[model samples]
Target: MVPMMMLAAIMSPSAQAQPAAATIESRAREVVALLGGTGDYDATFAPSFRTAVPRARFDAIAAQLQQALGKPTGVAAIEATGPWAAQIRIAYDGGTLNADLTLDPGGSHQIIGLLAKGAEPRGPAAQTLDAVVEQLAAQNGTSVFALARLGDGSPRLEKARNATTPIAIGSAFKLVILAELVRSIEAGERKWSDVVTLDGSALPGGGYAQQPKGTQIALRELAERMISVSDNSATDILLFHLGRAKVEAMLPVVGFTDGGVRNVPFLGALEVFKLKGVDGGALGTRYLAMDAKARRAFLDGPVRDTPIAAIPRDLFQNGKPLRIVELEWFASPNDLIRAMDWLRRHMDGTAGAELRAILSKNPGLPDATKHWRYVGYKGGSEPGVLTMTFLLQAGNGAWYALTAGINDPARDVDTLKFTGLMNRALDLAAPR
Candidate 1:
């Protein structure tokens, strides 16, 4: 789980531009072939890698893995970092292992680095919170985790790791959006059935964005989609309706105390898409330099008119996760716990019930629902960010909140592996 750094021999800085799709594909094929003992080491690995781990040693290692994990299968996935490096998922008969793969940044595109890491641990690893934190801290650029029991007052921390440090939470910030909408409803300022129009910006699956621009939909449905599927278009509409200033204010009230200064003039989902999509992400490079005022001006001025079609066809595929750590939503695992507690405490009337339904619609971790009387979950991810938060009511009606987030900022973190770790954390925090 350590933050991956390329071997010093080719420690070249990555261009913000994306790596070519063909390069990723070819490198993946070569690595798998090499693992299977069918490809030549000299051809598959660069001289730097071969020099550090000799051809004989690499062959022996590959043989050892085959003995332990069975045959080397195809590359399951590749998460590219900028224009040079990628984290590759290699499938095997028993399970999977990850490879930190890098190509020479020089025009040659030679395989400059290759380091194979162990497959994810089974249920045997991380028996305690301290153990879990060790694993988490080792795995990402910054990892924040919090587990708390909720009561009438503040949440009680059972275990926490850098719980107050802000890290990008990706779409998990939709929780705040949901929170703000619920708060407004409780204050009689809004209603679940209130209608809003769609702007039809594209989202990853067909969202309201695919519908006609003039089409109207209920706020409840929008919130449901935003949380249940992490629907970006739906989130943008709600953010627009609520206004950024209002959502920004809701941050600390829910849990994130520094949201205003950290994320001034808040951003919508489409706005982020545009920022990362235009001019090969040159706009983001410029946008990153500004203060709150300048950023607001830039986003509103030229950035506003950036076309929807301007978003890359491979927006998430082979794309560098540009400026996500700085440009996206920021929250701590502690903040998420308090946010979940706030939503739990709000459940006294219709607004409360609606909030529960929206948050519970997905359960993010569906199998765990059997362990609690009630389970409401919302999670989020991008290329290099993964965050999950859960609100649970135990069989004894005791309430608890569990959250974990990993921000790599270099390559994508493995979703299955992180979820496995969080699953263990939940079992420890609230055993069946």
Candidate 2:
């Protein structure tokens, strides 16, 4: 819910000290121009904004915006809220939206924050956060989301749907590996620069997978690739070097609190692909049917040695999702929130800056980044599942964590639709 304080207008008729009304208005107009697809980042946005949100990202956002809003006919003159801020009205053909612009006082007065808030007849329907939760849960398949404010004490779950039950989260499990890597580094057991040899079990959709069999890669580079691109090879390599037992041990510390019992004998990316991505999930079914002890032995035996090319490709390409559930790594939205907050607590200042940087590497989708000062994100998906979780820091210095996901056993989850809904939640959940 957007509190009354957030609705506390971003305006000041007279207060002084920052930029002139004319300068603020001009910068605000430049923001509109960028949204209209005619302005460049270096000229209109602050250094920090440019760094946090890249040009290509902004371009993509603008394209999506233009596609939705039609042509940006004009922008109203902005009112200077302070030396560094203003709220402007932006008019589009289909409808209209408002933008809150913030400028930097240090050197060139470029915009640091550009929050585009447009409450359609649709979302932010001037509605509560629960509305979005209900909508997500009401989707075709089982949809879930957990919203919370991160703090020193226990997190207050502001909204939730199926947030306690663990659900399949394809690649987001990489966060577990990342947390374990950080723990190992802090324990002086490993260094980010440590090099490891790569085995030949490569998967589709990863650059590292294309490298030579014995190629050497640094731990830091592997992590970056694993997260930024969802590099299956990089993730497997890290899991191999860190040891499954250690990574599994760190799961509860990061948020799986099940003591790794549920995910016992953790399966690597190669094993997952061999089982779930092939045989119409027959292999996964057989593997998942075993007990923990038997499962471990199975992984150590046939599952580990089976090659990805052992089957005819495209057997499952008819667009049907896999039937395996317990085979993939699983977590609830609240569990992911706990994991994100755990990372945030450990990464204070330089203590965990590099680690935090890894989380902030992609920021996933930019729809939420504009409203928050810091956006650290991780998203996962397969044919039947799509999950996105974020660690957002508001301008008021308050921190928030949220995870939204859709799980359908029969169909391909709609990415764009889920993303639009998730972005709406961010817009409404954020402070104005």
Candidate 3:
């Protein structure tokens, strides 16, 4: 999760440093034009802004905005202005966009913060929940599942097209870790603040892995990375320290065993990467033939022994193929929803609030928040797979959980398309 102070820095107005309204307005317009691709980043950005947001990243952001909301038609004059910052309403081809910009000091002011709100849903409602989900599934040509319950704990909607069928759901399996960690903490088995160090098995991903080896980290921070940033190294550190066997046992304990789908056994990011190093068919045959005990031993033996560096840095670089449907983590949409609900029930008081806070660290579905009083999100994606699970509380004090995943065995799923659909699905279910 981003440090709370960083957000504070962005939102906190500087004392006696507020720029004039005219300056804020011009800078806001210029930054929006840069993001809309009509202006060049190098020519328009402040020195610090240019350094922080390179030309390529700026271009990618502009392209994404174009793809997601279409070309920017116009931006309204500044609606709100703060010291070095301004907010504006923008009109796009598909929907409206709200943008906030913070500028540097002096006459050559540059944009230091350029944050954009996600596009809100704009479409006709379907007659039934099933029809809405099914239409999306048919349109995407993939499996889809969605379940939303009212604040009173009554079922508002439940629909699926092959949702129960297990598919690899990248980092969404981290939900199991977060839930189990909460349970362990409640039982006094582990403390969130306990300090731990990286091991040889530490693999590359987000957060601390980007740091040098042997960096000491707090357990609470590890959990934050797992949920908020989906950091792989943080996940492995927790799994290693918590014991994979315990997490394995907790799966069924959390109601994941009832689905009859085989619960994923002894798989972590590092182990999954190593598993891809061997013959795919042989690996499948050998793994499927193993009993539970054998699988555990296998993970502890050959899988654990594989060197971290031996695993390629890029798992998706053409030839380094992974068994997306079989070798990696697997969970049905129903299982994921149950996991979220299980976490909700187990997390209470300060512990619950802390977990939810970490989850809110990434407000992935901006439109969903329009209906929910609070929303917590965790999503996972890898080649050919994308999954998102949400724990939500409605404005009326109703609680609901929603999970959606899409997979294509032949190639990578269109990530932006799936994400847009997921946001739309939540918006459709928000009213109930």
Candidate 4:
């Protein structure tokens, strides 16, 4: 949250006489209405307006003000100048005349004050915001991303890392699950307190929530764990309960097409779906090994005209071989951004507040009091894959949507290093 400061400079009445109080008040009220009623005066508008106009030029200010106020919501006001200042205002429907505003002097548009209308002051001055963003972008390395600042329900600084290129996004697809759960709860399909028991036999290797198989947990708890802690067991159970078909059916409504849980018991499903060389006689053998060289050669070689094995029998109960399945859990950057945008708008107060609480409790956060920014992320990783997607909210109301993915097969590279690089890139896109 940014700080709010209303500077009051008392100017003595001029001996030459000034405009009538009624006229001033009338103009002020008119300006207010033109700018979307009294509510248009938000924190985001103050600094820009203050910088663009001086109190002395009431008529000129009033004319330019009307134009600024007349634009539709989320559309930035065109730059205008008055003898004393430069200003911009964004109107929104909310409490008081809240704003994320900036002001600068008329002579050179030197920053005078940068404050939110009702919140506490954040440190960056208005004049430095753009520079900070540019500096950060120059320092980061992720391939595709976007940064946006929400003020009065509008996104400011909505810039894509590579205007058109799309990158593969990994685990970040879990946000889709979160969205579906919220929608289901909102639609009265389920309750947050509804309890669901976990079947331990369903836990995947190397994932959170692999223990206490029969433990009962609420549906909402599973949703939270799947996202906040990246718990696979909770995710698997939720997927099963929600049903793969039901979840996939909601993607179009959420503005997503290429991402969703494609298979139940994802790991096992993938093994079954992509069966290539596993033999039927290998059933019940937990320790079977195939040469890495041979596997790679087979994977890279040309395809044969003969029908490939689609299922491996004797691998599971019922004498049925596992079916090959591919979970649609990754997405292109464009689709990922659209999905995140939807989440930002649809995230209800309860879920958003809960996530905030969880993030505050995360032990990985640094102890520094400089106000660590809040970022909610859902990530997915596997051997030969790394993916992360997040919505970062700065204390100043600046927000960014970021997605990064690497499919390189080299397992030696550090995952933390990759994640750090993504974070650094986001910091550049939306600085504190």
**Highest-lDDT candidate:** 1
What are the per-residue Cα lDDT tens digits for candidate 3 across 235-307? 9888878887788778876656533336557578777766775443454457667887898788788767656
- Which stretches in model 1 have alpha-carbon errors above 4 Å? 1-92, 95-125, 199-206, 258-260
Clashes of 4: 37
On residues 188-228, what C-alpha lDDT tens digit does candidate 1 reach at each position? 99999999976654443325656887899899988988887
Predicted candidate 4 versus true structure: per-residue lDDT over 1-432, tens digit per residue = 111222222333352113322222233333445454343333323443443233333233333334423332332232222222212333432211222222322232223332212211223422433443354344323334445554444344455554234333444556666667767776778777888876644343223333576678888667776665555556666766786556666566555654333322222222222343244423212111334344333323321111234333212212111211122244555566566666676555545555444333322211111333766655554433455566666677655566655443333112433444454455455554
**TM-score-based ranking, best first?**
3, 1, 2, 4
Off-target runs (Cα >4 Å) in candidate 3 are 1-92, 95-128, 148-157, 210-214, 258-261, 277-298, 317-322
> Which pairs, if any, clash in model 2?
18-83
- What's the distance in Å from true for residue 73, model 2? 17
lDDT of each: 0.74, 0.72, 0.66, 0.43
Worst 10-residue lDDT window for candidate 1 reads: 1-10
The most accurate candidate by TM-score is: 3
Worst 10 residues of 2 by lDDT: 1-10
Question: How close to the true structure is residue 205 of candidate 1, measured as C-alpha lDDT?
Answer: 34
lDDT of 2 by residue, 314-344 (tens): 4333445676366678888877998898888
